[model samples]
Target: MLSNTTPSGRDVLLPMFFIGLMFFILGFVTWLNGSLIPFLKIVCELSNFQALWVAFAFYIAYTVMALPSAAILARTGYKRGMTIALGVMAMGALLFIPAARTGLYPIFLIALFTLASGMTLMQTAINPYIVCIGPRESAALRISIMGLFNKGAGIVVPLVFTALILSGMEHVSEASLGALDAAAREAMRNDLSQRLVFPYAVMAGALLLFMGLIHVSSLREPVLDAADAPADAAPRQGLLQHPQLVLGAITLFGYVGVEVIAGDTIALYGHQLGVAHYGVLTSYTMGFMVLGYALGVLLIPRWLSQRAALAWSAGSGLLFALGVALGSSGESTWSQALLGWAGVPAVPDTVLCLALLGLSNALVWPAVWPLALEGLGKHTAAGSALLIMAISGGALLPMLYGHLADVSGPQRAYWVLLPWYALILFYALAGSRLRRWSVA
Candidate 1:
């Protein structure tokens, strides 16, 4: 549990704004993978499974380095820890320059891993810091406010990045490349690869600027006290004794896996569904997420508890998945109506359901963080690291989805999301309430 002594609204206003900026940065860099997947597939000539390594390399860093990130935060505190994380991300961004120059897929993967390592550290520091700064009950609201910035960046980055590097990419498929001579193919790949250099250099510069700002800012470090320890538990029990934390970690894993599938895979799904302007369609998925986060910020802790919000979000996900699977075969009047309303000529029902998944996913993270970390007290940092590690779902599950897409069709591969959402719904309804471990 967090301290009861809530700071005045004015005291935290600036820090919260800065923290939101960090979330924005996190979203901007992280969600670029959506566009990068198809971009790299074209530039590097990758198969479906090979292109999905973009997500695997990016998200697996959380599993690999989250505990180390916790250790780094323990030593440096949140203020300095965030600064270090930003500096590390800047370095990772700089690596893109050479990776783009070489056009090597492995080097690009390395850069993504390095960048995600920094994001893992940044998340490990900021999530708990946000919860500790304010009343615990309102943690979801604060996180939702930050998420607006986060998903807002998600909405923008793909559009801007695709415009910059992937204009006319729909025409650059394997069939077209095969029609070209060897030198022409190399020239095309090299041209596509070079487009990434200037944008990433600008990213490197922006990250360094934010690093300097965070270093000089006076963000307070949270102090854990003896009161945070469980009253009935032994003096030094391990985290495994806490059933809620353990279950919550699994819940988070499922949530992230499904969320990544919804957001990152939308463009690819659109492509498979034969949507011509799939990049533009993908942005709508994130736009719906931003709207949902805005709603969360308004309603959480005021009209709805975080747990209730999570339950509703999970239920919505289940419903959406059912709709996607059952309604995808042929378009109904509703799909046509929706497309007409949006002034688009046609959209497959599956694509619309995938976009609406943004609404289902928007509240899960904010809700899950508070539920998972609640009552961990002194173990909060470690518990947070564990939850962050579960973000490996984003890495592994997408690859699984890709493989399934190759085996079956892309539309049917979404069956994989149904089971993950069922698990999250279980967590929202019961698993989050199973807090058997004492936190005195």
Candidate 2:
């Protein structure tokens, strides 16, 4: 029941540019958790398990708010919804002012939750809007183009943030901190906490500015042609009856889990492996993701189908995981060489795997979304919300990885990504085609 009406070139071009900007904003704010995980661990004096609450509090908002976000979007439409979302995010950004002043870890988590709630609404609006704006067959290509904006911000935010706050942090450690007197420890915590204030204040102001811009922008809502309406009037089944959607939701869950682990945990993993510039190395992961997005923009739909892209991404991820495991055991010279060539010569082999994992993750989101929502018609909004909810995998899986790092070693903790990628492979191969529910 999806609208088959193709947008004019101008119609697509103008909205895509603004939507791409929105995506860039999402990536800049979302991926900062990569730097923040290590930053908060030091500032708040947290265990590995405890620090991952950064991801938990941020992503859990999606699971809790996605349905409500969809309902809000249904009433408000995309432009108004986006304006509201941006305003909400600006408020969340302002919460950091109090959080930094108080230096309370829980307050920081609350601020993240508030920020993610706004992002949840924004995503719920923009994703389906993008799909309806173009040909269904080329949805992957369009989304991949947006991925470029997203990952471009991903690449820059971490580098700039690391330079701003995490510089000269190589000498700070739990042992070194324990050796410091109470006054010195308190002074260090205050300094670390205050480092985030200016950056977040800038973020708040920019978000507010964007809210005003979107409020006045002339973006149009998608217009569904009459011919695209469902032919039958039979009662539709619940969303659970669509097997492809259910499986696709699970695929997104696993995809986001591994992607979050690769991006967010790599710094901590590299630090544990004695890598001095691990903060900068985190940008390398986003860089590879940008490369993969570029490739997806080039190859998807024109040369390879979205399904084929997913297959290749999953296979590459599996191979990378194998390399990481083998390199951990010192069984792969090639893996060691790859890590050395990546310029983190002192980093563990597993950190290299984490960076490369970004390549395998790059196309999954673009591919999975179109495949999942292919025939939902009027149900598209509800389906999109479900997919967004699956992003809570970002919340849960990294916390599990953190706990595993605490119990085992960071090198061995990467074993978690293997099963996640394997499940994604299954979805690429067969699960996406399992549409039991009729579109009518």
TM-scores of all predicted structures: 0.94, 0.93
Q: How many clashes in each candidate?
A: 3, 0
Residue 388 C-alpha lDDT in model 2: 95
lDDT of 2 by residue, 185-288 (tens): 98988887898899999999999999999888888766655532222232335567888889999999989988998889888766666677767666778888
How high is the CA lDDT of each candidate model? 0.84, 0.85
Question: Which residues of candidate 1, in runs, are more than 4 Å off?
Answer: 1-4, 227-237, 329-336, 339-346, 437-440
The residue-level lDDT of candidate 1 at 95 comes to 93
lDDT of 2 at 124: 89
Per-residue lDDT tens digits of candidate 1, residues 1-440?
33456577765787788899999999999889887887788788887788899999999999999888987877777789899999999989999999999999999999999999999999998887787777789999999999999999998998798788878777877678879999999999898899999999999999999999988877766655564422222332567777778888898888888888888888776765667766666577788899899999999999999888988898899989887776754563655776677765466887788878899999999998888887786677788888899999999999998898888877778888888888888888888887675657
Poorest 10 consecutive residues by lDDT, candidate 2: 227-236
Q: Between which residue pairs do clashes occur in model 1?
A: 230-439, 230-440, 231-440
State which candidate has the highest lDDT.
Answer: 2
